[model samples]
Target chain A: EPEVTQTPSHQVTQMGQEVILRCVPISNHLYFYWYRQILGQKVEFLVSFYNNEISEKSEIFDDQFSVERPDGSNFTLKIRSTKLEDSAMYFCASSEAQLEAFFGQGTRLTVV
Target chain B: AQSVAQPEDQVNVAEGNPLTVKCTYSVSGNPYLFWYVQYPNRGLQFLLKYITGDNLVKGSYGFEAEFNKSQTSFHLKKPSALVSDSALYFCAVRDMQRGNKLVFGAGTILRVKS
Candidate 1:
């Protein structure tokens, strides 16, 4: 089966530095989403993107966070200034619609 | 508002025995429920979903879930568990009125012992 792919399985960055997490969703999927899981915590939604624009976002997705589908295949989440709290496993998911979303393995972000 | 509740934080069962992970949900409209499993250091894997069908839905890895509308529950079950089935399980619900966003439960850790 085709799967969503994420690059840089793990990342370590300085607290004030910028970080970008990349994902390549299933080729035929239309709706894309970003979610994060703090260690030993529930997974939280960050943002949902469709039609090349943000559909909805959670409070955690604030001014410092932005998502871009730079090309047809790559979707990227950029954090302008990383904070220690930003360290988490970021997951990328896609769906043909809503009820069936496929998830990527996730990018582990570590800030120090 | 929509939400999912996984009542158990952990469930322990022996290999070759039956196992169940309970899940209940609340939604304003028709519910699209799902079950997913996660191994350590991996992303969630889709198991099954209840859109609009018979109460019972069978999925990957010999897993099945029964959607009880009146009870507002979707409980995952396996006839004979295996040590390999040890993982974290999550239940999710999607409200049609809320679009495609899925509300997931905190997750349940299943440990299958020999």
Candidate 2:
């Protein structure tokens, strides 16, 4: 089966540095989403993108964060500046209209 | 708002015994419920979902869930358990009225021992 793919399975970055997490959603999917899970916490929604614009975002998705579908296939999440609390497992998901979303293995971001 | 509750933090069962992971949800409109399993160090795997269907929905790996509209529950079950089934299970719900984001439960750890 086709799967969502994320690059850099794990990342370690300095506290103030910028970080970009890359994901390639299933080729035919139209809706794309980003979610994060702090260790031992529930997964939290970050943002959803469709048609090259953000459809909706949670309060947790603040000014410092942005998402881009730079090309047809690659979706990227960029954090302007990282904070310690930003460390978590970030997941990328995609789906066709009104179906279950498939997830990627996730990018584990670690900030020090 | 839309929310999902997985009441148990963890459930332990012996091999060959039936296993259940309970899930209850609240949504203003009809719900789109889903169950996902996470093996250690891996991504969430789709288990099953309840859309507009019969109450009983069968999914991957010999697992099934019964959606109770009156009680607002969608619980995962397997007639018999296996050690390989041990993993973290999450219940999630999508309220189309609220946009397309999913709200996930805290997750329940299922441990099936030999």
Candidate 3:
């Protein structure tokens, strides 16, 4: 079965440095999303993208966060300055019509 | 706003015994409920969902969930638990007429022991 793929399974970045997480959703998927789960915490929604633009975002998706669908296959989440609290597992998901979604393995980000 | 609540932090059941993980949801309009499972160091895997029609929804791995509109809940159940079923499970909800983002509950850790 086709799966969502994320790059840089793990990342270590210095505090206040910029970081970008990349994901390649299923080819035929029309809706994409980004969610984060702090260690031992619930999964929190970040943002949703459709038609190459942001459709909706949660309060957790603040000014420092940005998402882009630069190409037909690549979707990216960029953080201008990493904070210690930002350390978590970031997941990328995609859905064909919003009924069921498939999530990527996730990218573990560590900020020090 | 839409949200899901999983009351139990962990549920322990012997192998071959029945198991149920409770889930309650709050959503405006019609609720689209879902169940997902996660293995160690893995992403969330879709198990089943309740959009409409029958209240009983069957999913992968012999798992099923019943959607109760009156109680605003969708609970996952399994007839006979297995050791392999030991994992973290999550309940999520979305409004059918609303957007695509899904609100997930904290999670329930199910341990099927032998």
Candidate 4:
């Protein structure tokens, strides 16, 4: 079965530095999303992308956060300047038609 | 706003015994309910969902959930628990009238012991 794939199982970045997380969604899916889970916290939605543009975003998704489908298969999330609170497990997901999604193993991002 | 609530932080069940994880949701319109499981160092795996059909929805790994519209609850159930079933479970909901973003509960840890 096809599943979303995220690069860099874990990442440690310095505070105030830029960080980029990459994901390869299922080949046939059209919609993609990025979510984060702080340690011992609930999974929180960051942003959703469809048709090469952001369809919707949560309040947590601010100016510092941006998502781009750089190519047909690769979706990327960039944080201009990382903060300590940004440390969390970032998950990438893809859906066929905005229905249930297939998730990646997740990239654990730790900002010091 | 749409939201999900999982009252229990943890549920312990013996192997071969039945288990149920409670979930309740609030949405303006009809809700699409889903149950997901997460193992250690893994992503959320789809278990089951309630779209628009029968109230009883069966999902992967011998898991099932009953959607109660009146009570605004969609609780996951398993006939016989297994040690492999020990994991963190999340309940999520999407408001049909709203957008597609799913609001998830805080999650409940299921511990099936021998």
- TM-score, model 3 to reference: 0.97
TM-score of chain A of 4: 0.97
Over B2-110, each residue of candidate 1 has an lDDT whose tens digit, in order, gives 8999999999999999999999999887888999899999998999999987999999999999999999999999999999999999999864444467778999999
TM-scores for chain B, in order?
0.97, 0.97, 0.96, 0.96
Model 3 regions more than 4 Å off: B96-98
Candidates 2 and 4 compared: the better one by lDDT is 2
TM-score of chain A of each: 0.98, 0.98, 0.97, 0.97
Instruction: DockQ each candidate and list the results.
Output: 0.67, 0.73, 0.72, 0.65
Tell me the tens digit of each residue's lDDT in model 4 across B19-105: 999999988877888999999889999999988989999999999999999999999999999999999999998644333677789
Instruction: Give the per-residue lDDT digits (tens) of candidate 4, residues A26-99.
Output: 99988788999988469999988888888889899999999998768899999989999999999999887647
| lDDT, candidate 1, A4-77, per-residue tens | 99988999999999999999999999989999999846888888888899887888999999999999999999
lDDT of 1 at B65: 96
**lDDT of all predictions, in order shown?**
0.92, 0.92, 0.91, 0.91
Best by lDDT: 2
> Least accurate stretch of 10 residues (summed lDDT) in model 2 chain B?
B94-103
Fnat of all models, as shown: 0.49, 0.60, 0.68, 0.55
Ranking by lDDT: 2, 1, 3, 4
What order do you get sorting by DockQ, best first?
Answer: 2, 3, 1, 4
Candidate 2 residue A90 Cα shift, in angstroms, is: 0.5
Q: Tell me the spans in candidate 1 whose CA falls farther than 4 Å from its real position.
A: none
User: Candidate 1 has which clashing residue pairs, if any?
Assistant: none
